[model samples]
Target: MKQVKIAGQVVPAIGIGTWHMGDRPAQRETEIAAIQAGISAGARVIDTAEMYGSGRAETLVGAALQPFSRQQLFLISKVLPENASRQRMEASLDASLQRLQTDYLDLYLYHWRGDVPLAETVAELQRLQTTGKIRAWGVSNFDVADLRELWQLPGGDQAAANEDLYHLGSRGLDYAVLPWQAEHDLPLIAYSPIAQGDAWGQQLTTNDTVKQIALTHQATVYQVLLAWVIRQPQVLAIPQTSSVAHMEQNLAAGDLILSPKELAALDQQYPRPTHKERLDII
Candidate 1:
């Protein structure tokens, strides 16, 4: 499997994302099974957040991951912007830990910027590190300018990763964010990596180039998309799914590499941004 070094640990480039999961009691078993299937398929990173399902997702993850050794998995959760303050951060983290049924998180992130000063959040995250509740902390929905601002803070240079919306159709990060992260050796944890490009109103799934590339690799179009997302170094794709078969297929994409020719073709279909484009979000 292809691997990306994240927060000083090498993990599979493809991970399981738990967003909008654990919302329906009817689908609980299926969701747990899908996540377990990904783990059994060699996925080591499991991304969740306190905001997801208002903690239902983390609760589901806690149950799904009960059978696995904690050391074998790199678990990531996030604090809501309102809870990112020094006063409320640790308490929120504790609640997340309780939901996750774990004592510590591999990575905890500031879900987004809020009224709290960035320094307060960063300082609290650093303090949490000393408390052993979180190994490292990062940010989400952060653009290049936000990242640059973060890097200038006292403890900001220690950020382990950044989670953002990235997919074949959304290439805004390609112009600046990717380059900045690559230069700083900070890994990007991409969310919604296989949204089929429909979010941007593009029918990327039916694109001729995408179709032919999927055919060439004997993979699903979504799999081809996942492969393309993690084709670069220090990049990880966390694509959420509630089907065991789809989870397995997504994990398998870690090993699917597009050739230079194939990549050029995809580029022709969805060209990289020439200048800064609007940062796409879900």
Candidate 2:
């Protein structure tokens, strides 16, 4: 239950991701249990998006969070790129709020860059903040250049965070995007920290390096991967889980500290960025 203060709000270092939460009817009960268990275990941040399961994820989150105190939870949701225009963004926000059964979101993000003008979208997001529909706002899947352009706008200074695919294998953001956000004091929400269960195929969890580290700590390969992502103070890793057991394991990873040598070993396996590279998105 480690906490990180980002964009003037305090949140858990490891949040619960609801990417494919409500997609399958058979898994609904387990999904709900996982979310509730995470919250009860002191995971305050929960992230979801309208595009996830076509909004069914948000609905499930709403139902699962009914008994919790809204003020204590850091709820986040994203608007699709196509719906980022001013009018559509507003409509989408309302729909998301209804589905979440909440009056305001702790953080609202633009899913990705779209055809909509950045200035207009920033203005609308600021307006939403003014009206108390959202507390803070940010972007997702934005690289350094996109972030630079975003900051050029009038209300862009209010940008809170940027989220993208960040994991042991995908370290592109370690080059420029991460440093830029750190300089601005904006947190980077790392989605797919385990590569959406592709970590096994990518050798993230099965490789000798990871295996050795896990053995040293008596931890699972998954915990080692989760630990690597959130080892930084300013980064937040949201790894989705449907089992309460896995949810507890994810929360415990917040305390899994990696030594400099172990980190170096990982770097050798998945080299950190040397020069500017396009951000990775999932």
Candidate 3:
């Protein structure tokens, strides 16, 4: 497994995302299996969010990871945009801690960007850090402008990482976010690193290059796509999987390497659309 250091802490470059595990018993069992499989495969980070099943996902993750030493895992949870106020942030973090069955999270992130003042959110996160409630703090789904605003806050320098949707099909970060993060040494936590399974069909179809490369390496299309994302400097991908077999496959992506020619060909196949176009669909 690959590792990236953020705020002086090392985290797995490939993590498990526990979003699909809702309140159902079967779903919870699958999530537990997936987490154990991922950890066995060398994943050190596990990401969950408050909006994921309205907190049920976190509870499932807590149950799954209770056997492991807390310090061995880089646990990350997010607060939704609507709960961005200082008071709400505090309450939300406490609730998430209780659900996660952990004393403190390795990282806490703002789930979205909205009307709340960035200063208030950052300040509260800083306060939590001082109290040792959260080891580090960052933002998710925030653009370059939002990051710039965050940097102006009192303790923004302590912000460890930024989470975003980054894959071969989604290159919004390439235009600005990637460069800004690189300049600031901010590690990027990539969600949908396989393009939510879209890359395996639309992006790879009729594209003989990717097919040839995958065939040459004896790897699946999903593995090829995930390898492409993890190849980027400072990128950590968290692809969700509920099945143990799929979890193993996702973890194997970290070991698959793509040739420069193959990488260039794949990049040319998926040109990113404008942010405006993306927002329209969202």
Candidate 3 pairs with clashing backbones: none
Clashing pairs in 2: none
The lDDT per prediction is 0.94, 0.90, 0.82
In lDDT terms, how accurate is model 1? Answer: 0.94
lDDT of 3 by residue, 1-282 (tens): 667886578776788987667668767777798899999888888999888899999989989997887888899999988788887888888899999999998899988887788888888888888999888898888778878988887888678999988877677788788888999999998887876667445665245776787789998777777888888778999999888988998888888878878887877777645453331112
Residue 96 in model 1: lDDT? 100
Query: After TM-score superposition, what is the CA distance of residue 191 in candidate 1 from its true location, in Å?
Result: 0.3
Lowest summed lDDT over 10 consecutive residues: which window, candidate 2? 197-206
What TM-score against the true fold does each predicted structure earn? 0.98, 0.97, 0.92
Q: How large is the C-alpha RMSD of every model relative to the true structure? A: 0.9, 1.2, 2.3
Question: What ranges in model 3 sit over 4 Å off?
Answer: 199-207, 272-282
- The superposed Cα distance between candidate 3 and the true structure at residue 54, in angstroms, equals 0.3
Superposed model 1: Cα runs more than 4 Å off: 196-199
Error of 1 at 60 (Å): 0.3
Tens digit of per-residue lDDT, candidate 1, span 4-95: 99877899999999998999999999999999999999999999999999999999999999999999999999999999998999999999
For model 2, residues 114-185, the per-residue Cα lDDT tens digits are 899889888889999998999999999999888889989998978988998999988899999888888988
